[model samples]
Target chain A: MTELTRIIELFQLPFMQRALLGGILTGLMGGMLGSFTILRQLSFFSDALGHSALLGISIGLLIGINPSVVLLPFAVCFALGVTYLLERTRLWTDALLNIIYSSSLAIAVIVLSFVGQYKGGLNNLLFGDILAVRELDLVFSGLLLIACTVFIGLTLRTQMLLTLHEPLAIARGVSVSAQRTAFIVLLSLVVGISIKAIGVLLVSAFVVIPACAARLLSRTFTNYVVLSAGLGALSAVAGMLISAAFNLPSGPSIVATQLVIFLTTMALPQLRALGHG
Target chain B: MREIVLSVEQLTVYRETYAAVQDVSFSLESGIDTAIVGPNGAGKSTLVQAILGILPRQSGDVFILGQPLSCRGSLAPAIRQQIAYLPQNFLFDRRIPMTVEELVGLGWDKLGFQLPWKDHRKRRHAIREALVRVDAAHLMHKMISGLSGGETKRVLLAYCLVRPRRLLILDEAPAGLDVRGESEFYQLLYQLKREQGWAILQISHDLDMVRRHCDRVICLNRTLLCQGTPEVALSSDNLSAAYGSEFVRYRHRH
Candidate 1:
């Protein structure tokens, strides 16, 4: 079969429908929140949260509960814990984040080792299997996407002001700490939902790569946000199609697509200059 | 009687364990422009930040327009709406993609949960009016990251002027400007203060500008050393005391 034929045939299946819908929703959330993540210098935080979420999944599997449900609370705790430590103590921020990132990932590996019944499950968690996207996962991710959209839409102006300059935001009577906590919480939620389809290792690429591309191409803040979101969705869908065609892993495929888009954006301005020359 | 716009009593602000500002007491009345004149590391910026409730006070009370401001939490929205602040060389990411219009639009006093559809025209007009006053009308659509230092300062000044305010606080706001730019900025500030009847409190190192423009000056070096008319408070003894014994007043010859 041709690559396009394979992609179209795959989408005709129920599982592919679920995977595509989940990927698109996850992509939209990641893109929207990624703008704030990159601007606030929390790109690493998303990666850390992704790694930490593996512990929650391990715990969930051990306890015979849904990993997706457990990931919500687990991600929230990790995000809040980091926020609290950063605020209360004067530790170097990157050091603190790295400490948490390395330790949690190590602990998650140990915990996953304890789950001996599910052979070869580690590979699935490390590299996602979008074909395994369940109806429950879709529903959970859909609800999360809606919540994220409404929250971001309503608070975009206030969030933009705060993200631009926090002290100025504080002076303007924005509850900076409160807003920060809320933003990090929402970011964690997005990361948690995405981990199932994008996997722990590759999830943050969905958040950061699209935003990096959008930042290079966009002239205005609004344009940057919109473009980031659009690029994320585009990457997710196109990556899924490419994965179907080549029988490749979905997470890496999506990330590879995003990298191509980012490189294109980077070269566009230089290409334009060359054209003018 | 002129209303007291800002009142700070026994305000002590600590940076880590050491007090950056200790026992700073002051008040600003309507229509009076006050300058907080101090040398480097004199806690002048800390005093303003503490008063604005952006920093935690060690032990103190701040009252703005008779409303008590807590030292721990954020300022009340109502009180914040009545005041304009230009932070000291405000730190932020220079590569942000925000426009001057978006930055100034957020400065409107009535920004809350209200829909943007209502009073959209009014918000646009206010932003443009403030930008025009700052002589940055042409930069309304320009990216904030792309602006020069002087242009950024002007844009931020327009942010302060985007709404009606009874009190204005500036923290070394003209630090990066040239002499001509600084002079023009102070001229604009003077006109705005008079026309709006604003109670102004500014932290400045420019003794000449403070001496010429300020109605009162507060000399500070971690604490309030002296305060009075610039002629009295800026005396040789006060300057020596606040700025240390090595201080020498330089007078420029025209």
Candidate 2:
């Protein structure tokens, strides 16, 4: 098939449309929140949350509930627990996250061992099969994207301040701890929601790399977020197209595309310097 | 009317049963410059945090501008709005992505909502004026990441001055300063005290400087051993009480 014919064929499928929409929404939310994750050094927290999604789903399956339905609250409460531990204890953030990641992985493995019939569904969740995207998933992803944008708009500046100096933020009359908790909760929501599209194994790749790439390209914080979200959305949708044509896994395919974007962005600075010289 | 800008009764803090500060009580009158002088780990910073409602007080009551603090994590913004705090700049990560202008503006309680564009001239004038007073005007546009230890403190000092609060708390400020820098810092504080009539609370180890500049001295070590005029509070006997048996006997020239 020629390029035009292939493009026409790809857009004709309803599942393809849903998958592309879900991927785009997931990418946008992941990108925007990922900027904060990288800036505040919460990549480990996000990664831990991503991994814990499997445990949440597995537990849901064990209790005979739809995993997707239970994933949101489970992820949020888990993130809050992580946040509390990070605050109440003197343990380093990464170390705490590592403990959560490993224990969550173990729990997931243990739970999956007993889940006989729902194994295929769990596999689809563990490694996202975006080709099976439903209309409900598209709706949920769209709502999350809107929610994430509104949240970022409302709390972005204060969040930046809180991230910079918690003590100072407190002294400034900002509810430092509350804002911190709210931030981790938002990260949890993004991580939890994106798990269905990006998968447990590589969700953080979407949330972290895009922001880092944007950081190298951005001179201002505003530009950092804008570029991050834009790059993320672009990669997510484009990678879904590639996945469709080549029968690749949507999650890893999108992650690989972001890596390529980051590399290209990293090289742009050098290319510009060379041009100047 | 009560002139006390801040009052603390039996303020105590503990770290896993180790009392970092215990039964500390004092009150500050408006426009009085009080110095809290102690050795390292003497709970000076703890007391400052308690007053600011930053630390969880194990036991105590704190009143700021006649409003009692409930030790419920942190006080409301309206309460903190009446105060300007210059905490230990050494604790802040210099790499935080902020400019001096942005940081100094953050001192205002309402600046969080206002665009810097709308408040730029008024805020800039105030920030620059404060920066000019502290001799940090050249760093107005500089990223916080690039500042030296002394420069960061100066910038923080400007932040404290940007808004005219009724009370000012300086905790271990000017830590990386030389004697000359220390002299300049106190002089500026003294000037601000005279001009603004805001109660000034200084947490430091510079006894001589406090003696020369502050109206009162609080010699603290987990508890309030003594609080009075610098001449009396800095006395050897009171110094022994505050610093414990191993306290050094610095010769008082006066």
Indicate which candidate wins on lDDT.
1
Q: Give residue A77's lDDT in candidate 1 (0 to 100).
A: 90
Q: Model 2 in CAPRI terms: which quality?
A: acceptable
Error of 1 at A66 (Å): 3.3
Poorest stretch of ten by lDDT in candidate 1 chain B: B245-254
Q: Each prediction's TM-score against the native?
A: 0.95, 0.89
Winning model by DockQ = 1
Q: Which pairs of residues clash in candidate 2, taking residues 3 or more apart in a chain or in different chains? A: none
Which ten residues in a row are the worst by lDDT in model 2 chain B?
A: B108-117
Residue B230, candidate 1: alpha-carbon lDDT: 95
Give the alpha carbon lDDT tens digit for every residue of A41-140 in model 1: 9999999888888888888888878787898899999899999999988888888888998888888778777777665377778877777899988888
lDDT of 1 by residue, B13-98 (tens): 99988999999898999899999988899998888888877888889899999888876745678888989889888667887888
**Candidate 1 runs further than 4 Å off:** A1-6, B109-111, B114-118, B249-254
What DockQ do the predictions score, one after another?
A: 0.57, 0.33
